[model samples]
Target: MYRAGIDLGGTNIKAGIVDEQQHIIAEASVPTNVERPYQDIIRDMAELVKTLLKQKGIGETQLKSIGIGSPGTIDAVHGVVLYSNNFGWENVPLTEQLRQYFSCPIAVSNDANCAALGEVKAGAARHAKNAILLTLGTGVGGGIILDGKVFEGAHAGGAELGHTSLICGGEPCTCGRKGCVEAYVSATALIRDAKRAAQQYPESSLNAMCEGDLSHMNGKIPFDAAQDGDTAAEKVVNDYICYLGETITNFVNIFRPDIVLLSGGICNQGKKLTEPLETYIQDKCFGGSKAFIPKVACAVLGNKAGIIGAANLISGKER
Candidate 1:
């Protein structure tokens, strides 16, 4: 049997057909029409799926299930997006809508959780029965996979690890909370902090690179600056890593997962960011137990972990 995994983003709606081995047999993607309203976007996604079917010579009857990796607070069990600031959705029954097109079971989870499951099933955390995947993007996103399954929690809203508080009454967070890990470690936060620092250290290469418009910075600002040993950018990145390390240390202390896979554009810098994080985690983790060190690694799947993980859910024998 074949399974389908769909990743819906504001920029792109990506999907792929997977076989039992979790290999991509066929795939489809299209730019999301965020300005065209919500229904139109859904239709566009559905059309993409149909396009995949026509190319792959598969019918709805050949598929076992479909899973959608959504971008916001989702009621996975009920297939409803409780809210999505990204997609402009509020309590929309996404899975139900898709079910009308395909009779197979449909499942949905936040993109981060999907990434976690993806890592556990087929990526960097493939050897781990319990692990977490952190997605560092414009904002930070995370998912926890325990016992080889995603523990979505009572409200299915748990494991917002990035949003978990680290600094109280500190920087403002998009969630209206103060000093969330996302607030401290996200790309936005990194650039914001770097800009503030650049104002004082105006001669730094980072300041020069952005032509003093630090607000327009990207991940490359800190990454490139650090590569060339810019003091301001190095300090900014170091501070960000410290915040991330402390937050993750708490997770290691509480859950003792076997692995924590870092997945994001910033993680692309690899050891430049991870070495410091590992050192800090080793120094600050709650347990003196040397045996409790979770293998911190970068995500192997890049962007496909979610699509592959979602497909894995429906890969076995059909019901």
Candidate 2:
């Protein structure tokens, strides 16, 4: 039976038809146009799905199920978006609305959870029965998998790992909290620190790399300068690693999952990123000698992960 996955983002609505092997054989996308009404967006989403089936020369009856990955606190069991700050949405009856077009089974889940499930099903965490994923982009997004199943806890509102406290009374977070993991460990946080370092050390390579224009600074600048033996950049990079390492250590000590997967553009740093995180985890995780150290790896599926994972939700226990 064929399954379809829809990745609903504020900027885009992406959908794909997947085979039993978890491969997306047909796919398409459309602009989300958030300025329009929610029903209009949902209409575009349904049209995208129909477009995919038509591309594959299949009828709606041939589609077994559909899954939607949306950004927000999702009530997966009920297929409702409890809340979504990204789209200023609340209590949206997602499945009920989508069911107007398809009678097949449909599931809704948080986008991050879908991505994590995608990794476990067909990507980097394929070999792991339990894993944790952190996408360090504009903000930190997290997903947890246990026993090869996505875990969202009660009401599907759990596993908001990014909002977990990392430092007390430290930097402000978008979540309106102080010193959350997202506040310090995200790519946004990295750039914030890089900009500060550039301003403080005008002679540093980081400053010159950005041509003294703080607005030009980004997450990659520090790592690039550090590689060229820039002291200020090295320190910034090291500190960022420490914060991330500590965050991973906390997860290791708590969940002890088989692996920890890193996602987003920051993972492009390759070994330069995972190595330091591994070293820090090995040294700082609880149980100095006998604890299980989860493998640190990059997510294999890039943007496709959300789509694949969302589709997998049709068969997921949480769904």
Candidate 3:
């Protein structure tokens, strides 16, 4: 049987059709235009699904279910988006509205969880039964997969790895918390560090990369400067790795998953990022490499992870 996966984002709504093997057979997307009413967005989502089915010549009777990966605090059991700062949404009955257009079972969960699930099913952690996925983007979002299933905990609000405290009272976080892992390990955090480093070392190449405008610096500036052997950029990159190492080690001690998958633009650093991260995690993890060491690697699926993972949620079937 086929299933439909919808990835709802502030900028776009992406949908895909997946077969039993978890391969996307067909897909489509549209601009979200979130300024419009929520109902208009939902209607567009329904229309997107119908358009895909029609393009593939597949009947609704042939599909098994529909799954959605949304941002913010999702009430998965009720298919409601409790809140989404990205869309300025709260208490939206997303699934109930979609039901008016289709009759199949529908499941909804946080987009981060969906991305993790996708990695477990068909990406970097495809071979592992228990794994964790960290997406180091504007924020450090993550999800945990235990025994080949997404672990949402009570209220479907667990596994919010980014929000966990990294420092007792460090930088403020968008979540209204102090010193969250996201405050240090995310791309935003990296940019913040780079800007500070530029101020401290006026001779550094990072200043030129950002045209001396700290506001223009991004996550890549520091890494690029570090590659040129700039001491200031090196320090920024090292400090970022240190916090990430601490967070990964925490997960290793707690979950002991078979593998840890890293995603997002940060992963583009490739070995420059993963090599040192692996070394740091190896030294800091609870048990040494002698006993059940978990491999840390970059996620292979990229953007497709959310859609594919959402589809997997409907059946809870692992490849």
Candidate 4:
């Protein structure tokens, strides 16, 4: 009747108790605390699970399973965190370690895949058989749902859509790739572009907002300025829209998915982000008629999608 979901993020460990209908019944949190030793971080997760379960009046026997959406590369079948940049984890069997405390079946997947699965099961992609869920946060993350299933490539690392080349040798990405979408259209890029805009237009208000703190700049700087009709802001967000549009247009040309869900805090810029992206997508996708484009919209579940989706990983599996 219930399942446990954990979104193990860089900043926080979010655990939720989800009903069979995919609604969150109760939730708990713990800091990921990457600076802490490895065992302590694992203890954080294990302790949170017990805390939520005990307070929610749910016993281990009532839980169908547990699902974890973890950062970095993972071996889901073996429950290993192969290598993760966030927690400095290497070949750590998280599920096996956590199960030592919970004694319940556990499913694990990359965070992006879990987000995509979450969208497919209960969020934006619910009605579609094939879709892509793209979350534009500090960086870009992607998940592919094909015929009602997460399409894991041979190594369970399929759909690195963000790293897909948009321009050859354009911008260097942390992933060691040049011209990846994240390099051009992520919140990182947005902030970088904002700073450049502020330099060129010293009179702009953006300079005052962040007080010149580059890290304080985010995807919203340009978006907020654009709302006020500032030409400098328009330039940054427009360029962002064009490159971002180009990225998804490529997906349409390849997969022709029925839906493409927009997500992340940056995406909430609303029509300012979506409208231009839709226009650019229509112009670039080669296969479709001029009149039609893939349905593109925001992800419905917000942050909870990850927690709810993590619970759905064992859709056809048992406790």
Q: Pick the candidate with the highest lDDT.
A: 2
Cα deviation at 118, candidate 4, in Å, is 1.6
Off by over 4 Å in 1: 313-319
Model 4: lDDT of residue 272 = 62
Residue pairs with clashing backbones, model 3: none
Clashing pairs in 4: none
TM-scores of the candidates in the order shown: 0.93, 0.97, 0.97, 0.92
lDDT of 4 by residue, 111-178 (tens): 88788878877888888878888878888888777777666565755677888898879889879979
Alpha-carbon runs more than 4 Å astray in model 3 = 317-319
Q: Taking the tens digit of each residue's C-alpha lDDT, what string does model 3 give over 1-319? A: 8989999988999999988888999999999998889999999999999999999999999989998999988888888999999899999999999999999998888898899888888888889989988889998888888888887767757789999989958999989989999999989888988998899889999999999788899888888999999999999999998999899998888999999889988888888888888898888887687756688899989878999989888665332
Order of models, best lDDT first: 2, 3, 4, 1
**Candidate 2 lDDT score relative to the true structure:** 0.90
Better of 1 and 3 by lDDT: 3
- Give a tens-digit lDDT track for model 2, residues 224-249: 99999999999999999999999999
Q: In model 4, where is the ten-residue run with the lowest total lDDT?
A: 310-319
lDDT, residue 293, model 4: 78
- Compared to the true structure, candidate 3 yields what TM-score? 0.97
Ranking of candidates on TM-score, top first? 2, 3, 1, 4
Question: Model 4's lDDT to the true fold?
Answer: 0.81
Model 1 lDDT tens row, 114-145: 88888777778888889977787888888877
Error of 4 at 147 (Å): 2.1
Model 2: residue 58 alpha-carbon error in angstroms: 2.1
